[model samples]
Each structure stands twice: as structure tokens, then as C-alpha cells.
Target: MSINLSSFTPYDLRAKLGEQLNEEVAQAIGYAYAKVTKAKSVCVGGDIRLSSESLKNALAIGLSQAGCRVIDLGLTGTEEMYFATVHYKLDGGIQVTASHNPKNYNGMKFVAKNATPIGRENGLEEIRVLAENILNNYQTSLTNQNLGPIEKHSCLEHYIKHLFTFIDLTKLRPMRLLMNAGNGAAGHVIDAIEQHFQNHDIPIDLIKINNHPDGNFPKGVPNPLLHDCREETSHAVIDHQCDLGIAWDGDFDRCFFFDSKGLFIEGYFIVGLLAEAFLSHDPKQTILHDPRLTWNTIDLVKEAGGKAFPSKTGHAFIKNDMRQRDAVYGGEMSAHHYFRDFFYCDSGMVPWLLVIELLSTKQQNLHNLLKGRIALFPNPGEINFIIEEKEKAIAEVENFFRDQDEKAINIEYFDGLNVEFKNWRFNLRCSNTEALVRLNIETRADPQLLEDKLTLLKCLLNKWIKK
Candidate 1:
């Protein structure tokens, strides 16, 4: 079937999945990925979406036609593909997932050998072109090719075993945990992990809410990042008197957390906490963090006797940097946590394990673990504004702050405009994935200063929007 070809997108092709679009996109992606990597064997998997199975089959057919073997990992998370690709030493892998997107939306994430992401600059564009060509009937290069056979495989056991490599089983303390899978792909994985914990007598109580994997998404789209979507998990934590609350999106590539106090810990703080956790284990370890917000991560990394380096915010960039630096750990403020042992790929599952280990070893509550850090560096989190003239707005922010060179201290564009001033700093960057500007501001242990500066920046943003 020849699709419009223009309908598919870069990174992941996300759109309503009910129509024939899902299969078409999958086939195009499989063909494009196979052609690009020229892999002898490729692993493919999908999340709990209703269309995932059919889409995975269509993708496998395309892969087979491209003369590539397909190892089908039935009903798995995105990280499973990454794990299987590297563990099996396959040529390539593809995961059919839209991450945290809506129920109607579905997409795909592709990785080459060693679980390397295929982003825009690094082969994603080429894949996009090939997929478009195939969809539009211009791709006659590999038609009627000898098909490669499909084989079923399961990495659940191995993946669960590998997860324990980050923690000491003896140190795992008995504590109640509240988990909200949001009816996503994580339920089964969580079940497997809990089974292991129970078998090993790890002493952890797993209290589940919305644990069942339902494609209908009875609660919502499984995006815990949205404040409204987080209520169930928060309420469960308070009502159950759980020590920790963890939530995952569809496909489970990212994870969010809530303290026993029912307070949601922003992903920014988790990065710092995880950095500290990983660094304490390996003093002088190199840590990779996104440039969007840096103060907390840098401070924690330094305090832990490790080195901190900033990368442009995104998985591909962070993963590449992690591999290059051989960093012990890498984390984005957006809940994507990466590890050195995990093929430098991000996993929503690993962060919580490490955090649990941290909690057990330190014997501190989740809230206690974060309270001091939150107080030390008060931030208002990231604010996104829809402004068509993003470049103009960013330039305006830079110009507005340019006159204070003496007080500005330092200015850098590691990812976007990051202007540092005395006691307070803000990074105003235009989102690469959308037509919007994102602002993050932080001040030294002073909530008032943080709010005051945030208000000033909002004034600037509002002023520019009016123009």
C-alpha cells in the first residue's frame, strides 16, 4: 500500500493508529531500517497498544522482505528492544511505541547494534527518506527479495537479571512501594520484577494501582508527566502509606516518582539524586546531564566526588555523550535515565531500582532524600510557552539580559540560551520538537528569589507574545 509518505514523521511516526496507517508505517520503518543497517538479524517488539501486534507483524514482514531476520519479542517495553539488541548482539532493533502519547497515537523507536538511537542527524533522516520512498512506490530497490524468517524470543528473565546488576540484593530493605502502571506496557515487567523480589525475599512490598495492562487506558493516556494524570498515584501513596510512588508512561521508557508525602518529585531533582547515587558508588565517575537545568546536577556530582558534563537535552545526545565519556550514569530532567552498562540507553525501570537501593542503603525516606536538595536549590520547574516567533523571543531574552554582562557572569548556548547571573540563572531555549520556548530558572536556596526571577521572565515572555 502506497501511503502519502509525507504523513510519517521523524524520530517516531506518531498518528492515530486505527486506520491502515499503523501497518503501513511499520512496514516502511522496517524496510528502511533493514536497508540502512543491512542487518542479518533484527529484533522487534511492541507495547500494549491495541494495534501493536498487527503493526509488529507488518513490520516483521517488511524486515523479512529486506532480507533481515526478525526476532519477535511479543508484548514488551521499548527498553526490552534495547536490551535484546545489545544482549543478543543483533544488527538492529525496532520498538513499536509512541512513548507517552495519547491512546489514539502510536509510533516506533529504532536502534542500531549496541542499542544506538537513530535520531535525525544520525540516520533517522535517511530512514525517513527510504520509508517515504517505499510508501510512495519509488522504492523498488528491494522488492520481491528473499524473505528472512521470523523467530520468537523472550528476554524477560535476562532483562530482570540485568536490572539487579545496579543494586546489591542484600541491601534492599523492606519497604512498601506504590506503583501506577497507567495501563501501559510496564505492568507485566513490574509483575516479573516483583515476582523476583518475592522469590528472593527482598522484603519490598509492591502495592499496585492501575497495574493491569489495558490498551483502552481506563484512566487516561498513561502520561504521568501531566499533573491531572498523576492524581491516582499520589492519592494511592497517601492512602496506602507507601514509602514511594512510581509511575510509568506507555512503553515505559520514562518513569516519574512521588514521595511518601504524596509530593511529586520533578525529574530534574531525580537526575541529581540518581547522579549522587551512582557517583557515591563510583567516586570520580563521570556523569552526563542535560543542559536544560544544571545547577543541582553539577552541585550533587561535585559533592559526590564525580565529574559532571552537560549535553544537549535528548536521548540520542545524552547516550552518545555517555558512551564517549564512559560516564557511570546519565540522566535527563525529563525522567529519562541512562546507564553505562545498559548499552548507554535510557530505562524507566533502572532509575527506580537504583533509587530503591539508594533508599535502603541510606535508610532515608524518599521525601527526606529529596528535602535537603530541594531546599538547597529551589526551582520553579520548566515552563513552556507557545510562541510562533521562538527565535525572536529567545533573542529578546538574550538581548534583555546582555546589558548585565558584569552580573550575567557567563552565557552559553550548549543547547539553547543559558544565561547565568549572581545567585540565579535561567535557560531560555526553543524546543526542537515543537514551536515553543521553554524556560527554566533556579536560585541558590532562596524560593523568593526563584519566584521573583521567574515572574520577571514571564513578564518578558508575555511582553514578547503581545508583540
Candidate 2:
């Protein structure tokens, strides 16, 4: 009985589930249950998508079929799922979310016991293979199992309280702040935090934009990385004369920051700030950073008496590296901040909290505190080039630059082609899941030179593409 793989597309399954059976979700759950054979119980959670409930129901059925008990924490973020894995002493956990993907898109994220991320190199590939096999088989013994007892545990309150423990509110000064949830799961989290502030008699003015959790997303996708999406958040801060602005992606797993002047602070600087913050308390601590942005981070971490290790850019990689290195903190230039205390997973909440604390303690403006580092690492942000020949284009650039005085710098091919000079460095790497190459370049304290080098790189890349 060969099952047609083409017939089991995620979209088709989504539609079929909407009509009659949730076979895709059942496969996911069955796969999870089979993976965690030793687990007596598993914690389950999901994002704010409408289909999450149906998918979760199917998943719960699969878990029960495998003789594993299930605990449901409905409408929670990915971080909360990680927290539940440890909080309830569950053997494993799954978060049904597409994260920052569009409203129509949905997927599942999984973790082993102790909140260990299961990515491609880890166990995600195995899970995917098993799930696909289960979906294709469809002839498994169907036991008329009774619905497992579901106990509702509201971890939101405890999650919020845990966030506050990482920062000192008493030292936070009264200031105007702008927050944008971008119509994602962050609305509930932000509202909960605000309620806590009010309850504690903290006098802070909050200006909010798109704080409501509307899945329709009248603005667009909740990704603040796009310039168009960030405009509203930037405007809110400037218009309200707010001291700072913060925006979260769809699931609120990553957050972006804006200073008092409505300047979009690069995630690199935020990483530096977080590294310094963590190092202040735990000197000589190991810090994990993505390979994309290295110079500034390495310098900052070293100056703060911390060892900086570069990991491949992604949540799973950072989480794995953090666990291996026992790093106190990890950060990516895309604004995902990971904390060892927070299950070694990225959190949108911690970065802003630490930034607020830094401002309050230093009594300095955000821009001023980061001015020197910003000058040192004048980045052109990240530019994506869609090409038919990604590898060829990368090689062309490497060859063109390889012969330009080797004695002045070093070239490393860890993740991609990284060319490091005395005062400048750049990395050009193809995206893992997209048909494009991403370019990130930085120089030592000269904006003009940075722009010039970026312009040259783009022209050079264009020439390679044409060839």
C-alpha cells in the first residue's frame, strides 16, 4: 500500500482538515509521541492561528494513541512551550506555530526534554521523515481510544512574573515608550506586562500600535525587518515623543528596538549591549553569537571579559551552542536573544528588558550609549540578492577579492565566504530556505568607507550575476 507523497502537501492537508479529517496534525503528533518513547507526559502549546486548535486536537489524539499523557497550554508562545517543558517536568513539548510566517502559513516546532531544540542536525529531520511516513501510510491500526483528560494550566501569569524577575523595575525611570505587537500573539503578552506595571504603581507612559491580536494583520506580515512594516513603529515613537520603540514579529519570539529619536537600532548593537549587561553580572561568561556579525560582538564580549563564540545563524543553532558552551546569553543580529536561564531559547521579552535596565542604570540615552560601537561597526544592514546561481555568484565574489593583498587580512569559509581585513569585514552567505544570497558588511568607524565598500560589493555582485 504505497501512499502518494504528492497528495499529502501541507496546504492540501490544511484544506482537507478544514473539511473532514486532520490527518496531517495526527501524523505530527504521532511522530512526536514515537520520538519521545521514554516520556510519560508531554506539554503542548500553540500560536494565535485559528487552525491551531484543530491541529492540537489531532495531535493530542496521536499522543494518547502512543500511551503518552498530554498537558495542554492553549494560545501560548514558543518560549512558553519551552518553559512548560521544564516547569511541569514534561518529557517533551511541541509548539504549533509558523512563527513570523504569513497568516495562511502554519507549522510545528518541537523540543526534546529539558527544552533542547530539535532541528535538522538534531531530531527535526527524523520527526519530519516519520511524520511524512505516517501520513503516507494512513493504514495504521486505529484504536477507538477515549479522549485523554486535558487539564488547563494558565502559565501566562507565571511566565510574566518570571520575565519581571530578570529585570529590576524599581530602578526603571518613568519614561514614554512605544510598543507594537503587529497584530500577533504579543498583544496578550504586552497587555499582561502592562497590567503588571499598573499593579505595581510603575509610572510609565506607553504608546501602542497594532497591539490587538488580529490574525488578519491589516498592515501586512508582522516582520519588522521589512522597511515598510517598521515605518509605523518608528513613526509611533517619533510622533508620541516616546523615549523608545519596540516591535515584535508574529509570534513575538523576536523584537526590534528604536531609540528616543526613532532610529532603528541594529540588532548587532543590541547584541553588544546584552553581552555587556550579562557580563556585568557574570564576568568571563561565554556568549554565543551568530557568525554573520562578528567584529563588533567579538570586541565587545572580549572587552567585557567574556568569551565570544560564533554559531551558525538560527535559533536552533544558537540554542545548541548555548547548551554546549553553557553560555549565559546568545544573540543574533536579527534581534533574537537567547538566555540560558530561559530554557536556552530565544525570547523577544528579555532584550528589551535588559535595554531598559541599561538605560535606567546608566541614565544615558540609548543612542549615546551605543554611539561608539555603532561608529565602529558601520553596517549596511543585510541585503538580499536573488540569483539563479547562488554558489557561482558567491565563488565569483570570493575569487575577485581573494587576490587583493592577502597579507592585509584573512579569509574564512565557515558558514560562507567571510573576508576579514584590518578594519573591515563582510560575509556573503546563501539563505538556507530561500533562493537568495545575503550580504552583511561592516567597517571600523568610517560611514563613508562602509557605504563605498557596500556600493562596490553590490556592483561587483551584479557583474558576477550578469556573467
Candidate 3:
């Protein structure tokens, strides 16, 4: 009997079929072979998950089956995969990762030559269809001709050297720094960085936490956005009297920062600061920013003689926009930073490096430098609401505040519902990857008003969810 695989959503497929494909390494190999049949080479990398190795094997088998040469970059992050794709000038690449999802889950991210992402508009949908067909058939050809050769390559040292080329460590000022890798794939790279500094005789105090790579995530999930997740890094910074603290997600492709005072630096402020930094070198350079938090970013970009372009939130959209505009830098409130020098790819490593350069060059403490800008947009951070009926809740919220003083408010529906009052604004967006809804509110300068609005929104959400 032929099953209707098309009926299953990506998440559903993950839940139902993720475990059945024990030999998925072969499937990935086959898919790569089938897609890049005419290509000269393909590069591969994976996140720090226990299942990743098995999946990589299955993928290698499938690639070999297609008769294409493969360069296996063992145990690396997504950005590293992109770097290998560009560095080798390979035909394409793939990274085995679910990206910040729980441990058991695993998936793949595909990229083309020059590290261009493959999305629905480009090639992801087609790839997904092909993968689905292979899953449905349940039969992979195990012929010798289908098997391709695998070559192991290590790029850790080369990647670190390449990263340093963009920012000169020699010019850096002495400061105490805290780094937390959350036991993902960032340890080796961080270690390499420390070695580089030590070897060069650079003067800086470094504090490390959970820097070892472990798939079990003994401390907690690698995500640093959650309040609970920031505890370890925050405590480390305070204990060490570090100038700054940085934490990365599971893949280490995105990094979050805290100042010396142990206060979480909002990603919005980083976006502006980085935009300003880039514009200093190239005036009026195009900068891409997500729409969630734009007022402050726009002001800073314009003040720095740079142009700010707003794009939908997501790596695919940001990358596409960055390429089209040749944006020098792009940032999202979620802490993802994209650099043009990094093949227009997002990297958790690059953000901290840039911040370090800025701190050293300006001879300013992290908090004092970012304090004024962060104060402009006092945000409640992001709050998630679990609702049975998402659409209904969204509509009710929209109707409740639509006409209640139009003169003092502005409303927009780009990605979700955004209501702007004279001094405060709030965004209500449904999670693209989950069933819950997220609300982010910020005031022009009032903390009390922000709290009140957040409370009212929660009450309305509770009312809608109960109904």
C-alpha cells in the first residue's frame, strides 16, 4: 500500500518517521548523489548530537551511491559547513542539525555553491519532496555503483584563522571575558581561539563555562534566550569580574551577550551597535534588520549614515535580502547576526568578535557603551502564550485594540499584529515553528507602562485560550 506522505507536515514527519530511518545516512548520501550528479564535490558537517554521527553515515552512503565525491567535515556547526562550501568552492553542502531543538531531534540544512541557502523559493521544497518519496518507498538501492567515496577533512584551525583575518586581535585592549558554549559544538573553536590569543601573547583574562562538547546537555538546553538558561553564564561573569559574557546555542551559529554587570544585552541593541560599527568603515552601507524591533535600529543606522532595510525574520529571508542589497551586516532580535564577509551567513562567533573589536577600539566598558541605546527601547523581552485556537486569539486581540484611539496608535500586520501607541508598541506573533503565540512589548521610556501592557495582553490571551 502506498502511503500519503504529503499529508504529513515537516514537524509531524519528524515525530512519526524520524526513528524508522536508521540508515538515513545512506538516504542523505543518495540524495546528495542524486542532486549533485554533475557536481565535482560536496561538503558536509553536523551539529553536536549523538544521533548526528549515525545520520552522517547514512548520508555519506547515499552520497557515495550517487557517485559524487564527499568531503566530510566531522563534528562542526552550520556556519562551518557554509565556510567549507565557499572555501573549497564545492558544488553544494549540507549540515546535519535540528538547530536548537531538543536532543533527540535531528534534521538537515542545505546550501548551494557560494554558501547560498536553499529555501522553498530556491530548492528546499523540491529536496523535501525527494526525501519524502525516499522515505515512503522504504527501499534504498544498496548497489556498489551507488556508493561514493568519503574523505575526512578538519577545518577547525583554518576556520579560526579565517575568522581572525576580519578583526585584528593585535589591536585589542586587555579585558576579562567570559564564554559559555553550553556543551554544544563551540568548545573546540573557543579553545582554538584561546590558544591563538595565548600563543600571540595577547593580554586578556578568559573565563569558561560548560565549554566541553557533550550531546546529553547535562546543564540544560544550549539556548541562551531563556531566562533560566542564562543563569550559568551570568553567574560565571559575576564571579570572574568579566568584562563581557557570551553564550551560544546548540550549533553555536548564534550568540547572546551579557555585560560585566551581569545584565542581558538585548539583541536589538547589538543589532544597532553592529550596524554602527559596519557603517564606520563603509558609510551608507545597507543593513538588514528584522521587523520585530526596528525603531531604535533604524535610528541608529540612519544616525551612522547607513541605510536600514527591514526584512521578515528568518535566516533565509535575511540572507536573501542581504545578498540583494549587499548589506554589510544583518541582525535579528533573536540574536542571529549575519556578516557579508562570512559569505552572508549567520555566525555566533562573528558577533562576539565584532563586539570585542568595538569594545577595545573605543576603550569603553560593554554596559556603559550600550546603556544609552538600550534605554531607548525598554522591552519586556519575548513572552510565549499557549493557546488552543491561535487564529481566534490573534483576531480577538486585533479587534480589541484596533480603533481604541487611532490618533495615538499605529497598527501593522506584516508578520503578525503590531500595535504602536504614542510611547509604547507591542507585537503579537504566532510562532512559526510551534503552536504557541509570542508577544513582545516595549515602551518609549516607561517600564511601568510596558509591564501594564504586558499584563493586559496576558489577561486577554488567557481569556481567548479559555474560550
Please name the candidate that would achieve the greatest lDDT relative to the true structure.
1
- TM-score to true structure, per model: 0.95, 0.91, 0.93
Number of the predicted model whose TM-score against the real structure is largest: 1
Where is model 3 poorest over a 10-residue stretch in terms of lDDT?
A: 7-16
Per-residue alpha-carbon lDDT of model 1 for 286-316, expressed as tens digits?
9998887889999889888999999878777
Alpha-carbon error at 242 in model 2, in Å?
A: 0.8
Clashing pairs in 1: none
lDDT of residue 8 for candidate 3: 18
Candidate 2 minimal-lDDT segment of 10 residues:
7-16
- Prediction RMSDs, each to the true structure: 2.1, 3.4, 2.7
> Where does candidate 2 stray beyond 4 Å?
1-26, 29-38, 138-148, 406-408, 463-467
- Candidate 2: the clashing residue pairs are none
Candidate 1, superposed: residue stretches over 4 Å from native: 1-10, 16-21, 139-142, 404-406, 464-467
Whole-model lDDT per candidate: 0.86, 0.78, 0.79
lDDT, candidate 1, equals: 0.86
Error of 3 at 69 (Å): 1.2
Select the stronger candidate by lDDT from 1 and 2: 1
Residue-level lDDT tens digits of model 3 in 294-314 = 778888888888899888787
Q: What TM-score should be assigned to candidate 1?
A: 0.95
